[model samples]
Target: MTGPRSARSGFSLVELIVILALSTIVMGGLTSVLVRQQRFYRGTADLIETRSQIRQAAGIIPSDLRGVSTAGGDIIAISDTSMLFRATIGQALACAPVPLANRIDIPPLTLANKNTLASFSMTPGLGDTVFVYHDGATEAAGDDVWVPYGITGAPTMSSVSCGDLIGSADLTTPRYSFPLASPLRADVTPGTPLRFVRRTRYTLFTASDGAWYLGYCSPDCAGSTPQPIAGPFLSGAGGTAGVAFTFRKADGAITAIPDSVAEVSIVVRGRTRGIVDMGGYKNTQVGDSLRFSVAIRNRK
Candidate 1:
């Protein structure tokens, strides 16, 4: 009925097969490139994280250790991987002394103008230690010393006139009264300086996920959960410690006694979270190690 059917204007079966084969090959190549790109990005992320962890450890650990005084009984315990010490957390001047009542009052921690002389990194609490500087000059020349006392209970905030130690404008400023485990010495008078300390420990510990981390324990480490400050570092395996602590004397000799330690060397080794491609079927975990020495500022 239509004057010889026109020839179909469509690809032949062989042409269709060839085009499909080419498309499949192109798609396969693209898929390969995408996968490689994804792997590269992931590997980069892991490396960055590893480096960040190492930096965190380097920054935080040194600051804490530098404040410790090896000769002053601040170092409670030390080992290859851990160290416990009394960390100074704050400094204040005694505004008033109630030695017989086993109490001492200091200027308010927070002032309206923020001009208060007392500064605390942490709130004073039970089990904290206070180092009161005794003006041995009050008794005899060259007899000055610091006396340590333990805090026994919660501190109370009360409005107390600090007299000349605080400005008259801040006369109504509240103060904190801390109860001590024992009575202060009779010589401890108003305006005496005080050092607040807390027991702190730093250690290398394995987390639940089988990764190593730098752990921070406050007050004490025994039976207390450590806060992870850094790492997924290299495990102490194959003759390498995850975290290593070396104590040195002033003359650079190794020391076992805490009081003899004048410097501390810290070595932290970090590793990538997963294996990274090194090209040509080679994949390995990237790692870095950092070593730094910290001079104990209060060692003398």
Candidate 2:
């Protein structure tokens, strides 16, 4: 039958074994490459996250500290890990003389469609403090200061027209009357400026996950819970601190007195939430840190 079909050609056993071995080697190399690439991408992501944490801490702290005044007692208290200060929330102009009563009036803070005669960053609320700029009668520079008054009750809307006092034609705009804890100085008259403030605190606090974070507490941190602003930062251990504050005087010397602090040095260290494989190391955590200083405003 066709000369015995010439030994039907096919791969021998040895040839099949060689082919399988080569395929296995190639697949192993490819898997190794894929593993390395995945590790690289993950490590890069962790590094970026760590840097973002540091930036978040940097953004809020400096801006808040820059608004504080050392000589004005804006820095209520300070320690290595925390600072309590008066944070300015809003500002407005007095439309009329402050009477010897427990109330003060500000011009229309918000007007519909019309130009606002007086504006506040936020509406004044109860328990907030207001600082009224006082121009002493004697014209002495030393005697001129900002007098503090506490708001006792909610602000009420009044139909009182501040157009005559503020020299604006918008008489229909209503005024906001804030009740005070006590009578203010009678000398606080028209054209005087006012600032609203709240006692705010910044501190490094431990979160529910057992990680440290930068926290912000307003009106004081004594009984109020702090809001986490940034971080799963490095834990404070072995002489390393997650956050530290150093107060410096004008001469650059460190000071413990809050009144003498002209500059504040802040150091924050951030850590990744998960372990990263990097540079042949496995299960390592990535970290980043930032150090900056802010000079207090209106430091006398």
Candidate 3:
């Protein structure tokens, strides 16, 4: 009655408690939404990267397998987590075809000689692979074949000093010649139909990092470190496994002959890695797998 009663200035205890509780609930919801979005982004990014790796492999693996140089256990050395095979390396032509010998003859066509230091791709090194094919129109009936040769040393080509041939003189071409692992079983003569020889290898190997990769090397894959053609085998529950190369005959039967492999089935498996454990996110994560069969054009 006399003076105004003291006005309430702050919230009551009960009111304060309710306000704090509501704020807590709101923040929790927002946090959950953010976390969910982040997780989704991570999973998507991982999947995309993995797919890119797979596509890169698709472009190379099949073609190399198809071009495998047939030989006795030389085309396909081992077909497990690791695979090894010979492939054509370059486009050096034989000016004159001669009988099977350990040496290859190169003409003075301004070719990029692998036997020269500037662009040496023909000089066979240890573990290098050499192959011969009859480009002749009338090859021996049974002579329709590809033979494999092992590389023994720094092969000598004609009288060239180095293995490079970028800007050499016309006369400097030197009629390149390089030795082979052994003498050829047949004759190779240059003409309307030229016999061809090549050097390269396709191999699948597991790196020190516990990942699988596809590698390619010149001459032979034996002594040289493989240049990865495909990489980072991400598979299994833990996301670390190698790709498998399955060779099949034209009739879908498994065979060992390099030329007999009519189809190659490749399978790649992988899973995304997690930054943090979200109730065992790996188990809940979707695994990735790529499988396809490639027909070998060079294989019968």
- Specify the highest-lDDT model's number: 1
Instruction: Pick out the ten consecutive residues of candidate 1 with the lowest summed lDDT.
Output: 273-282
Candidate with more favorable, higher TM-score: 1 or 2: 1
TM-score of 3: 0.60
What are the per-residue Cα lDDT tens digits for candidate 2 across 1-300? 366556768899999999999999999999999997898788888789889888888888887676677767888889888898888877777767545778777877665545554665566687789898999778778878888899987898765545455444446666888888888787876667888877889988888888888889877778876798888777756445788888999999998898999999999988777778878557788777899989987795
Candidate 2 has an lDDT of: 0.80
The residue-level lDDT of candidate 3 at 108 comes to: 48
Stretches of candidate 3 off by over 4 Å are 1-29, 69-74, 78-80, 96-102, 107-124, 133-150, 155-169, 173-177, 181-242, 256-260, 275-283
> What is the TM-score of each predicted model, taking all chains together?
0.92, 0.85, 0.60
How do the residues 1-300 of candidate 1 rate in per-residue lDDT, one tens digit apiece? 669777899999999999999999999999999998988888888888999899999999887776787767899888888889898888998876754778778987766666757888888799999999888656674578888999998899866556577766677867888889999989877788999899999988888888889999887778977888999887766556778899999999988888888999999998887988745424888878899999987675
- Highest TM-score among the candidates is held by which one? 1
Clash count list over all predictions: 0, 0, 26
| CA lDDT scores, all candidates in order | 0.84, 0.80, 0.57
- Candidate 3, residues 1-300, lDDT tens digits: the string is 598799879999999999999999999999999988887777677667766777777777665555453333335554644455554444454444346556665554444543322223244356555555554447556646555555566645564332332335544656556566686555554421222234455555666776666666665666667777665655322324447667888788887666576677777665554442343454264456678787766554
Q: By the lDDT metric, which is better: model 2 or model 3?
A: 2
